[model samples]
Target: MDRAELVELLTPDGLTLLDSVGETDAVTDVVKAVSRLRAEGHAPSLVAAVLTQVKLRRKAVAKFGDFASRMLFTEAGLEQATRLRVAALHAGRFTAAELSSVADLGCGIGGDAMAMAAMDLAVTAVDADEVTATVASYNLAPFPSAEVRHARAEDVDTREFDALYFDPARRTAGHSNTTRLTKPEDYSPSLDVVFDRAATQPVGVKLGPGFDRSLIPENCEAQWVSVNGQVVELGLWFGALARPGVSRSALVLDGEGTHELTAPQDSDDVDVRPLGEYLYEPDGAVIRARLIGDVARGLDAGMLSPGIAYLTGDRDVTSPFVTTFRVLERLPLDERTLKRELAKRKIGALEVKKRGADIDPAVFRKKMALRGSESATLFLTRVDGKHAALLCERVR
Candidate 1:
């Protein structure tokens, strides 16, 4: 949002209108609300701003849960904000290390700051964008010990705080439609400077889960976090915040609960084996953390193929780190043969999962011309160095 729109939305009347509007996600509801608000003599700018926030708040619910209703968000800020559960874990690390104060540099919309402050730690949250900083201040208003500053992260003196948290801006400057800055040097406050500061004090930096593993500092703990099967962020912790004897970690948050797999370094891959009665798909965080081998060993499983993430074993073991599927039968790999087999089984609804295969699932599904009501998961992958289609059912 622009400065004028923000100015209009921050007033008592505008916020009251926003609250009154509640949530109008439907296009029809939004249009009707706009007409009614304008008819009631509300300013066009205020109406637009209020509705925009209502939509953003709805989208923010996935990340912030109930707290999103009371929060203000920029489109980009909300998109980049950490999940509340993950943020709480970040806060817990500092508290566990006995750090009472934190300098949250490049803190977009105060997500991490809110979590830290809620844990009763003093927080100095800084962001380069004025609108985002203002929104962060509003989100952090409930925490008396938390302060928001609109300034470049480099300008802050980090030595004053007991610990430091860096969430460098990875997108272009804007409230919306910002391009991702892929190069580490393109990040705001820059990785070089952030790592330099980490050398002397306790520091934690949050980056995308796909961050270059080679660049990870040797002295820090690299943790990849996934929520509900999706790998979200890779966090690097240095000094006191870094867990002892752990360098690589995968943190999985799912319906079961939180589970973590840690190793001194990347684990060695298991030898490839023939397909078993059941197949396992490791969670993305586990794969990204390079702990798939550890998980495979735990399940008494072997790789379906070298360098592929899928695992297979005859045991009926299960773990939160992997989704298990029972092999129903083997299907032909050729499109014509696969289509004929699918027709014979009368299989219609399907979930296509693949590893070490080049075919597009959508196109393949379309060609199958499915007409039956049977549902199954088709795993198109390499088994014993040959392309195979494993018709399976989810075991968990």
Candidate 2:
């Protein structure tokens, strides 16, 4: 069916034709219409429900079936929601008394704004897309004082807000490719512009979890947050929200095992020690924020290698920022020996982690002919400028 037909199908008269459809072709037409509607900022939940109904009856077009399958409630959707909620929760971490007015810059789908308003913070949510703005308005309907505006973050004035929250648009028009906004000027409102305007007020920015550490500004306090053992988002707090000597933090939220680690400032010169019997590796966000040292000191652990971001302690220590691993054995990075040991142990499934190793994990795993074994994590690293492997088990 053509775009016209699909659009027609979405109309009241055409929707009534659903009772007459009995073929895969009709379902395919419906899928196309649903996809178009979704692209045009239609309610995803409604579209997804309709699509599921079509799929359940096995009426969907063969080609479109695969695409429709992606719409199913799955880990991807949960992960997205979890990540957004994590970021929203971090907004609550700002040590402000009460937010009278807030600006949610680049509020995609208005999730963050909705969360803020739910916390009683009056919000002005801004997004660049009209469809997103509409969706945002609907999402934030419960918060009567929350306003959804279709505008670029840069165009929105900062003076109207007592507190500012930013979640920069990470995807472009194609939506297939994603890139981080590193340079302060790359963001819509521009980090520098936002910070300059918010220097005196509380400001928080939600950044990608994988954001480069070097890009973090010195004036801000960066926090790495993990929800359910998955590192989700990095947050930057500036101006009144900033902490003292603590420039970075790692926050892990678990019902009974919550943890928080604060990183020491760069101005503080710290000593590094050798890797002990146990090694702890902080998450990417914590390492990027240059808070590994703080985490190490917090846990009474020392750095194994300076600038390596790995913590070492002989005794068991608990910290939210670092994943503790007990080093079982260390061996030279001899592919043949490694393969032989792995094969001997019937190790098939493996989780490969690399710090500064040159070998590709995929290639190495394939070369090992790994199969028919339980789960194992292989740590590939460089020790004394030589490739080495450490067999490790989770300390928890």
What would the per-residue lDDT of candidate 2 be over residues 95-154, giving only the tens digit for each residue?
253557888887765556656776777789897865556545655776787898999888
What is the number of backbone collisions in each predicted candidate, taken in the order shown?
Answer: 0, 0
TM-score of 1: 0.98
The candidate scoring highest on lDDT is 1
Displacement of residue 26 (Cα, Å) in model 2 is 15
* RMSD (Å) of each candidate, 1 decimal: 1.2, 7.4
Q: What TM-score goes with each of the models? A: 0.98, 0.74
Q: Report the error of model 2 at residue 248, Å.
A: 2.0
Over 4 Å off in model 1, which ranges? 24-28
Segments in model 2 whose C-alpha atoms lie over 4 Å from true places: 1-84, 93-95, 174-184, 210-215, 255-257, 267-275, 298-300, 372-375
Number of the top candidate by TM-score?
Answer: 1
